[model samples]
Target: MFGGTDDAVIGFSGTGGQSLRQQFVANYAAKTPYLGLLGLSRSPTTISLPDGYSRSFSSTLAGAWYQGAQGYPASLTFGGYDALRGNTDSVLTLPLGAEITRDIVVQITAIGISSVGDPATPVQNVAAFIDSVVPEMWLPQEVCKVFKDAFDLEWNDDLGLYLVSDSQHEELLSQNATVSLSLESQGSTVTIDLPYEAFYQPITYPLADILDGTVLHYFPLRIAANDTQYMLGSVFLQEAYLAVDYHRREFYLSQAQFPGNENEYRIVTVHPPGWSHGLSTGAIVGIAVGAFALVVIACGLLWWFKYRPRSKKRASRLSAKSTEQDRDVFGYYGREKDGGEETYEKRELDTAEPGMRGSIASRCELPSPPLPQYSPGSPERDWPKDRGSIDMVEMGDYLTARRVPVQSPVELSADSEHERRPPPVEIA
Candidate 1:
């Protein structure tokens, strides 16, 4: 089937398998908050304008932002199409306009249609809290979709080759064209071709390079649509070179070339019309996995960065701990420690001069150390004269010594020959 007519059957797909989100869900994979959007690109960095931009649902995207124009500021200029159903690159960098990307959060202060009220004239600071909503995907709006028969779906713009379900009611459509839908059902192929493409270019700066988070803005639509009249997008707009600037309320666009070796990302594109992602499942999956991996890897690297310093600091503590102590109380010699060390009393010798009273007699020669005396016949009898330390009287010249010569005074005398032990004497 080619173009559809008013007679073409128009009904919602109520069949169980007909649910729109069914095949797109990842039943076997780990679930993510925005996994559905991952069908566009692997993650945030790879995501570009319009479509790709929307897929980034990271924390950096928090607060308000804006992307593709479902609702837009009235200040922008809408650029018409180059041709019907063809590619037209919006000159974003030339400052002629801004090509919107996804992942942009717009504070949607208003949503109105071309035929009616303007929402941007709120007369105050436009606020956010979802002032309006992007219409849901499922709706029987005035969209150019395939139909089974001529119903409300039939349009004068439709190419006339495709017939509706019933032959009774013929529908009007454009001539010499073909309309098509990949929708395969009822053993019939239906399609339509349209000669219409349009783009909007608003004067913008290069601020829209990245997008994410809640978007807040005042906007009026070029055409108003019901809750069901939402646009379907592919990943191209997101993965393409793009920018968004809500501070200035402007969008920037450009052709993002793939980085040869550097980490710079590549732009996404679409080969056919009405493709939300790429034509093949492989393309869709590749984009999704790539983006997802990039985010996960980035997050992992950040954690490693933060935790790495902590570990290094702890390791350095081991070196510092050793120096903090004078020595291990038990020692660290790798062998059994010997017996307790002999304790010595700290005796402070009076290096200070003792004055005249402290001086020893010149004849005493600092009092020659008395020798030990003993009877040779017995070992115990040989009394040892332990060394005596001197304690002097504060005002007296004589030093006090507690000592007894091991030998008798007679031993000092030349006549006394008996090996004798003298009683210990305390010389004061």
Candidate 2:
């Protein structure tokens, strides 16, 4: 009879209660040394509710069995898996075998000791079933021999196990060998690496029948008589994670992570196809906050571009109007002439016609004292051609006699007669 939590019992009720029977056999035979079995099958148990409604229990099973002092605590998850217990990125998913006799069968392509400096044992299309009911791995005789030679293990005929002596255990520990098992199914391959510590299972009491109270550390490996007996038992699970989806007949295998005391529990739910379990409160709130933030940003942008202050635009328009008023009808940049406006003292050339070039010199001439005449060979007449105009030097001496500051000289060329006119002066 199946007895446990209602959910556990109900989950196995549909799968023929085979899990309970297996547990019974394992417990009686002492096959499972650590903990009892927990079935994670796809079977659904239907029960009638008080309101004449029926409910069915169906969920996925995911777990990891970690042993030894350095291993993490064992974890068994229903309806989901612990994300922290396995490397989710390296998980290998494969469909379950079609045979009714086999449940979680996979093809083990190769097995080797990575640190032993020896070639891998070629398994070659060997099908093996994974079970947690038994504690040791039942591999082919050739593979067992290879493992024995590599690990220096001794086969005990009385115990029917590969036992390791103290010296052998110490040597193996110092070597720190890692056993790699390559599994393939449905064209997908995954290799799981197990440290030497994973196989060093201690045998004691009823399991070993040791009367002297000596704990014998043995390598958990058995020789299979035929291919049909090939099995990777609980020892393999110590380093491999397993998840079963009975509804879809699919299973997954991944390298188990052992973080010891630093490990955290992170459960991720595995939902069935077409099943909907509405979003959590946290998720809903997060989405709502994100949507609200987007709306706020959009509104802020709309206000900035469409509804913000138009002071800059108004200022631009006013400046444009002022500019238009300042321009004459010809579009020249000057203020419009008005009556009674104070007119500035201007040179005679300011009123001259544009084409009246010949009259420019006479119009700009002021009634000043005449300059002293100089001989052809005199210093004044032969002054450097690079110097400023002669008129400017005489003006400077004149200004100095009157105690006025001399202004900067303006160079004038004889070829540019039209450019010699004085600038218009403003009246006081």
Candidate 3:
């Protein structure tokens, strides 16, 4: 049989059944949470029981099991689990409080093994590996001898394994034989005791070589021929919870617990190192939207400033040019007597005629005879032959006299008292 996680288990049956019929069986069980973190790193690893309770992984480091150069068993802290409260069997705990090292080495010293009623002794320092995939303990051939002698077991040369009678198996179960390990921590010694049940297993043989009329039974134990390595497999793990901390280079082993309810749980946040707080998706989206809106607003304001009309500037420039025209060409300072309000308003150029300034200067220098004032329906009088154009400002009493009524358009001389003076120009 091979079993660890439900996802990876295979079982086989051999020659023991009636008619020697062969069959293969497979099954799946609940999804084990710890199995999901296998071969993965930097994940929020956790494991929970049937109850709602859960325990999160304790570090920011990734949990990679059985797939790296530094593979370790999933172990809990040694004293983290509660004690076995109601069990009748005597259990032992050996605390291996070695300082954490870079390499997460999980080793326990197996001192010795014995059968029913035999006094357990300490073997030399024996290293063992904790592997859950292994069905049972794998002991060295020499260490297997100790168990064989203590139980008075027979060895079969053909099978190269120990053979236990049905009576011996029953007696061993009644006596509850044990194996021992010695751990040294801080100059003090701790011992771990394993009962006979921890090593019990059922073995099967192939059906191809069954003899006629011969009955065959299953044997569980197997010995390592080279005596070089010993393994503590799932049998031990079923009774213990192992937690490994790669960052701290340490591990803990405690007796497993089955909480009836999920109320009791410790939530741990396991994130990558240097990770504290980060912006959420909503916050990032909000900031992006705000930035885009601001950009659009800025572009609108820039376009308005660049292309909008400048009516005030055009008005000011036209007023300044009108004042310049009044000072340079017409030079008019006419007085008005209407409604007790004295007003002087400069008009813009009606026509842009060249040499008009010289003609006005010549007409102002000499006085001519006064012309007759005509009524609305009077016959037309003969006009003077010298000046061909009329002064639009002085036509029909439109331009008020400067405190004097002139008879003709040419009556206003350069030295005449009736000449109008230019109005004052307002700067700015």
Best candidate according to TM-score: 2
Ranking by TM-score: 2, 3, 1
Clashing pairs in 2: none
Identify the leading candidate in terms of lDDT. 2
Model 1, 162: alpha-carbon shift in Å?
A: 15
TM-score to true structure, per model: 0.17, 0.51, 0.37
Report, for every candidate in turn, its global Cα lDDT versus the true structure: 0.29, 0.69, 0.46
Location of the lowest summed lDDT over 10 successive residues in candidate 2: 396-405
Candidate 2 C-alpha lDDT tens digits along 1-428: 23333223422234333232322221134433434334445454333357742333332232232343333445677888888887898878988887655678988888889667877777875788987766789988888888988888898999888999999898888888899999887788899998898788788776677666788988989998888888888778878989888777798999987654434578899888878688888999999999999999999998888766575688889999885664433244443355868443333344343323354433343334334424456555455544433343345213211112224546689897667765322221
Say which prediction, candidate 1 or candidate 3, comes out ahead on lDDT.
3
Residue-level lDDT tens digits of model 3 in 287-377: 9999999999998887678644465677789999897676556644565666899654433432333324354332222232234334343
What's the alpha carbon RMSD for model 3? 18.2
Off by over 4 Å in 1: 1-90, 93-229, 232-240, 254-428
Model 2 CA deviation exceeding 4 Å by range:
1-35, 43-71, 260-263, 277-428
TM-score result, candidate 2: 0.51
